[model samples]
Target chain A: MDVIQIVVIGLIATVLIVVVKTQRPELALLLSVAAGIILFLLVLGKIGSIIDIVRDLADRAGIGSIYLGTILKIIGIAYIAEFGAQICRDAGEGAVATKIEFASKILIMVLAVPIVVAVLDALLKLVP
Target chain B: MEAIRSLVQNLIVIIILAMLLEMFLPAGEMRKYVKMVMGLLIIVAVVQAVGELVRWDYRDEIPPLTEKNNEAELSGIMAAASRITGNQEQKALEQYKSGLSKQVRALVHLHKETPVLEVDVKVQSGRNEPDYGQLKEIILFVAGETSSGKESEGAVKEGVEPVTVQIGSTIETDEHIENRDSPAGAAEADLISMVANFYNLSTEQVKIIYR
Candidate 1:
């Protein structure tokens, strides 16, 4: 039922964007961004539940919170960067989209610094 | 066996998490970068779990590298570790000294002629010393008169005499002369030599104080 509602809203938004794009391109872009945000918000509630499940599983498996935290941060950064980049691409700003993605990649690597150091430290301890 | 079971369980959970997280990833170039980080996290988890199985403690997880200056933090950790080591060494030395003193007291008590009131033993505890933990000195505090017999007759006379050191290089020249002149000096010397021989120490290392 929720999917039906989402599909209907998406279709209506697409129709409105198609009808308005020729007359007012800026308005159409705004409508598309608005629709994307609405759809993301609708799905966001479900994402929280999925995250809770992952957290429980990680706890049971004896994984450290730090690793899980880093992974979660990377995922969030990727999702947000991808969302922004896609919007930029839709607006015909390919260069801006590329810059957004490059920034996200750097942020993800920065977040991963601890895990990388942990791996190296563990290996070093095992060696001697 | 329990560790193996838990390791398998952990791997399963990690794989499931990776799959679920992968589904959340965008179908774009950013996916690769995110996946790389997830892969490293899984690697660390697996390595740490294996370390636990081998009885090697991976308790000290590495802290965030970018949080502070690495050299300063490393030096701080080194200093703390050395301080803990020093405290433990000092405690062990104290216990060793007490235990050695008790053993010496018990040994001297075997000879009823000398009733030992107290025993003090010192050991070379310096790490740099070649004779570390070797008996450095043993001081026995004995009653003024022999506890075996003729105690009533000799106690008053022995009590009137001043404290005397039967052996040891640290003894004053006058005390050494007085110790030699004492009536029971030969018997005390024999007892002191017996103690030195038992501890593998030189005669001078074992000192007896008549109190």
Candidate 2:
């Protein structure tokens, strides 16, 4: 679905949640969380499709499939770390969340080292 | 999976019923354990339900075949890339075939000939400048040329390289000659106009970089 459809559905869901909250606050919270999750799943599907296309293109470009995999894995790590950190903050464990974010960055940097080394190798070979 | 789902659903019902029963029963030490069990059962039930759903969805689907060689897939990928990078795929392919002989002798390391690169045009209006719809037309004109597959490949290998073209007047002030905007009592108004103009981007399309 397009951005407009997603926004309209979100707004409708938010309105339903607000109305439900007035009667059953607990159920309303649950429904709100479910709506957010459903939306997240939809967006995640789009991102996965995009990543697949990028991977295919990178492979065709002779950029190496492994390099694309590394980039995607790095992206996944960053996203998961951010996701965990956000959940921690929502649970009032901001310190733990911050630690998770820090760890994710360090891990990403480590993961990127191989690509960096390969790029350097490519450049050096180009130098004569 | 079906059995697991049924078990989990039953467990949820049991937990809810237990919580309700505890509300009526006497407030004793057992109440705490009952509530704890209720929470554990609920978590277990939800996890099992989700797992069952995933299993059921994938049960009939064939697993993707693993392939080490991706040369054919790579060609399809290049075609998609041509479309994405605004090159005519057919044109690029034709150019690739025609130029293969020339490229083979020139470069021994690179197997495939690189397509002609495209230039990107970025036009920015002044903060107080009026919006011009013509900019969009210009961008489309520059971007739209990738109709043939041959031309597309040619563009990718040896097309006009992409370049950003910026068009706007720089603001000048006594304090700073290279100021982005005119500074005066109109700071807020100027800033708002600048922001609005910035959002009104036109012709951010890719163009071929002709040699």
* Every candidate's CA RMSD: 13.7, 36.8
lDDT per residue, candidate 1, A1-128, as tens digits? 88997999899999999999899989999999899889989988998899899899889777788888889999899988998998899888999999999999999988999999999987675653
**C-alpha positional error of residue A108 in candidate 1 after TM-score superposition, expressed in Å:** 1.0
DockQ of 2: 0.01
lDDT, candidate 1, equals 0.79
Question: Candidate 2 at B205: error in angstroms?
Answer: 88
Model 1 has a clash total of 0
- lDDT per residue (tens digit) for residues A30-113 in model 2: 666677677778787677666665555443333455655655565566656666676566556789988987787677667666
- Window of ten residues with lowest summed lDDT in model 2 chain B: B133-142
Q: How close to the true structure is residue B94 of candidate 1, measured as C-alpha lDDT?
A: 92
RMSD of model 2 against the true structure = 36.8
Candidate 2, residue B109: the lDDT equals: 19
lDDT (Cα) of model 2: 0.46
